[model samples]
Target: MSEIVRKESFKHVSYLWDDDEAAKLAGDEVALLIYRSNLLGADLRLTNYGGGNTSCKAYAKDPLTGKEVEVMWVKGSGGDLGTLKKSGLAALYVERLRNLKNVYRGIEHEDEMVELFNHSIYDLASKAPSIDTPLHGFLPFKHIDHLHPDAAIAIAAAKDGKKITKELFNGTIGWVEWQRPGFDLGLKLKQCLDENPGIRGIMLGSHGLFTWGDTAYESYINTLEVIETCATYIEEHYGKTRPVFGGNKIESLPWEKRKEQAAALAPILRGFCSSERHMVGHFTDDERVLEFINSNDLERLAPMGTSCPDHFLRTKISPLVLDLAPDEDLSDTSNIKARLVPAFEAYRALYTTYYETCKHPNSPAIRDKNPVIILYPGVGLFSFSKDKQTARVAAEFYINAINVMKGAEAISEYTSLPRQEAFNIEYWLLEEAKLQRMPKPKALSGKIALITGSAGGIGKAIAVKFAEEGAVVIVNDNDEARLAKANEEFGKQFGKDVYITAKLDVTKDEDIQAAFDAGNIAFGGIDIVVNCAGLSISKPIEEHTDKDWDLLYDVLVKGQFKVTQAAVAIMRKQAIGGDVLNIVSKNALVSGPNNAGYGSAKAAQLHLSRLNAAELGADKIRVNVVNPDAVISDSKIWEGAWAEGRAKAYGITVEELPAFYAKRTLLNEIILPEDIANACFVFVGGLLNKSTGNVLNVDGGVAMAFVR
Candidate 1:
């Protein structure tokens, strides 16, 4: 028996399959395949994000023929296994797939082969099939799994991987030489399987593991068996190769200290990364990253690049390492900035050379030359992408690569995929076509914004608008309950990574700093600031109290000033021009009865915006005004005494206040929070992007409030 078949239980990797869960879907092979895939994908040790494919062959009734047909259900292209669902699996006609061999011209017609997959699709509702569909279809097994488990890949990427596979799995596992994944690679997998009838699986050279069986459980268990056995073998050899990664060359910073350093460097690195196109960033101080970066071999291995296609496709060909002495202070950002400029320039030049050296006549043009993954020895890793989730997954994939490198170097000499081979995969025509099909990025795609008082009212509306247009938002509000609900709402609307929340009381400088600090660290830095935090009191000049004036000025005038100042400092540091929007009022321009403290504070806020706009224009920071009068829906202020105060000012009941305000406007329409939000988007959403130090009113057209 093959060593993998003889193994009854796992020794290294976790056996996550619960018989009860499997029994619930026993009759459905496709559901069982999805269940097994999720279990394997949930563990990063098995596969990185969107890294592997799984499939099972099953009998399905043909709609037109009314007869059972052999069909293949495989994970679709760009689908994550852990989150795989019925919609994520592509259904293909197995007999049709098998017949494609007659038309398979050769590997040179790979792109044409992908087009043929459309012809073999069994279900119209099915997602697009993956490139590895042929790898599973050509095999004889009823079920199959192709995973990039670190341990197996360690064996696959080792110099003596083929030799290691023979000894490790005995006769049960076979091996194939390195080839980029495509129809040719699929044929090689089939050849390996046909030649070794008794083997349970094959190891794809410098790539990953392939395991199969008759049933879903059998296939899933067989995979765990192979991976766990390889883990056990690597561990035994790893013991002999003591001091992994040639031992850590520098002591890792304390967890808190490392986070502090990461926060400081994130924006600076993000700024450099945004040279070609603005990029959002994700930071990680995970122990895996800390250990790898602090190691002596990191300088040697990180530059050599990642072995697995999954790793390099996300992390790029090589990482840009920002090494520092043990005693060097990262707090001196200027010093770090000086080093990063040259480092980024050199990395871009080298990447361009790689493209020039390996370009084929029809190869895709060179992509973003900036390093996707950036390393800071004492801090951790920072990954930059067009959006939050991509940036985060890039970091996670790099961590997986770190594990693979550690294992390979422990048991055998680690070898990266050849640069030419990597270049082929990176610029493949099929991959380029996939990228082209993605929807164009939104206006605020790579920008991060901070919107104060964002738990509700105009603030939340602005936050939601920005998030919709593809900006990561820092939503700030002082109300704990409202903030939590906003968090839940935003998480449900947009995936959780798109926005973050912070408790903010605009009157307090500490709270202001905390919010900005949270914004800077969570998302590289804030490129847009909207100051909408305010409360109003409609009182006669004599009746206005010291408490009333202080509160109004605190939130409206002074608070907006402090937040803008903080945002500007970071914007200047980022060297990327930004947008500053203030939510002033009609009261700032037009004098009205029964208004003293609130109107004066708003007037001060209005002038402060224009003055800052005048000075900050030199920094390319555009400060503008969105004067929204009587915004009522979902407003915290309108829900409380402010409504009563405003109603009293108009000599009307609170219920009649909406109509009273609307009647006064030129358009005779009630102003909604969303209306203000739409106006805010106009200023920063690249529409009125050039018009700064200007005012746009969103009050259903209050004629007196027009900008001077």
Candidate 2:
């Protein structure tokens, strides 16, 4: 006879709830619901960022009839429970929502079901309901909470999950097998409750847990109780002899060293993943990551499946593993690329085979056949996506999955939904429609941009514009105070993570190299480089000293070359071409008196841009120049002595000098910093993807500088 397992009690488990705190939450049910949802989301062990949802059944007065009616306030579609607000919940009439099932014919598709669910809303002002509304509606409870808690999923995904669940809950909790969430799953939940009338909750096998009560506190406490019980069971059974890799700790590389190593290999991985679409890479090496990557069974267990079924949408069914030896030197770029290229090809071939073998007749066309997560033996894990944020999100899910797998394997073997079932969730019509409904991203959504002299004036304006269009920005300037102010301003408008500030003097090759390396580490690689750093020196040829001539050339010409050289090396390795925009003056094309030092340097820089365009065109790198005559807004170049000299030459006061230059153009309009920013956007945003070796005049109408 088999030994009987004792049911574990959760008397020692701690919770975040306090009766005093609960009573002080605005004295309303919706506020309580939001609080409960946030409390659950705060603990990643309880729920992921946007994975779980909570709902409460309450009474609200109908605005039309002035009568109280039963309503369910559920988390709205696409709302993150971590930052949930009152506006994030949709209120629907209980009877109206229940009646949705009657209208659903047996032949209705997922899209048709979503439409019916939306029509069940009691108020037109409420947001759209979540896809799982019927699951909450059919259950006979006043308060319901559903979450994909890691501990609960660890139990639910075991090979003998039914046996383990009965032992832990003493048969007081009902169990339902895995089913795609829809009207059918709702009916199954109702059936489970009917069969086990005394059960407090139902555990959906390989999915999640559902608990309910008459009050929000009751439901939340019940959820914690069940989660605690599962955790205790895993502890008692698997906590003692948990498997470890070789039973010895591996001396892991430091984070800074890992980043340095990643800098050399990330571009090669990005190059392999790039096709018609570009891919950005992000690296992670937390404690949990180290445990998983250093495990003895990593190659066998990691590729089985995700911790939960919904994760398939973001992380795919499995991750691709690479053989990065511990003793190998990662700083060698050539050796790293030679190893990574073949691995990438093999992973793609495997994915193609999986897609052909598992896709259903109704499945949507296959997405890009590249892996989102890659595991390196010694270094760490790298996640790829269209942008940095999404890449980080994928990494978070993978980390959570690693933890859950460890817990499940401690008791029994881990199991996941089969390939066909995973494919059903991945290609669901309603989920696909959500992607379609999202507003189109800006033209440069996933690209990285580096701008020099971005503390003020045209450089600052261009930095703001690129951020608005969805590019991650690297703001560089020699002035520390001005750069700090720019950082604060950009952080307020966009997010703090949208841009990084660095002190750079473009004249030094070392400074140029360090700036590019910082950007490559912060983001994956550099995609756009704009050289707008310059100073003005207006004097006659004979009056100008050699010092003045060298200073002008060092900034305008030599500095531009150093920055471009560093950018091209990174771009060439990425093999995904980039854009280079140099902010020149109209003086480059049309010379003026007493402008010998400035004009000669500007002209040399202009020709250098043309030269880069000629040499880098075969690699798909585009180089261009934007020449503006006068832009006095926040202009440091036109201040003090330089302004007085230019004004005296124009036979006007300093204040009228701008107007004097404006009147010379055919349009007679003064150029602003935004005008030059717009022209840079045009070339860098791929509007002229095929055009290179070009100069655009932003001087309102400079006929002499205009290209035929």
C-alpha RMSD for every candidate = 2.5, 4.7
* lDDT over C-alpha atoms for residue 549 of model 2: 93
TM-scores vs. true structure, each candidate: 0.96, 0.91
Pick the lDDT winner: 1
Where model 1 places Cα greater than 4 Å from the true spot, the runs are 1-12, 326-334
Query: Backbone clashes in each candidate structure, one number apiece?
Result: 0, 0
Q: Model 2 segments beyond 4 Å from truth?
A: 1-27, 103-112, 198-200, 228-239, 245-251, 326-335, 539-547, 639-641, 648-652
For 547-646, candidate 1 gives per-residue lDDT tens digits of 9989888889889999998888778778888999999998899899878888888999889998998999888899999898988888877877778877
Best by the TM-score measure: 1
lDDT of each: 0.88, 0.81
lDDT for 223 (candidate 2): 87
Q: List the residue pairs that clash in candidate 2.
A: none
TM-score of 1: 0.96
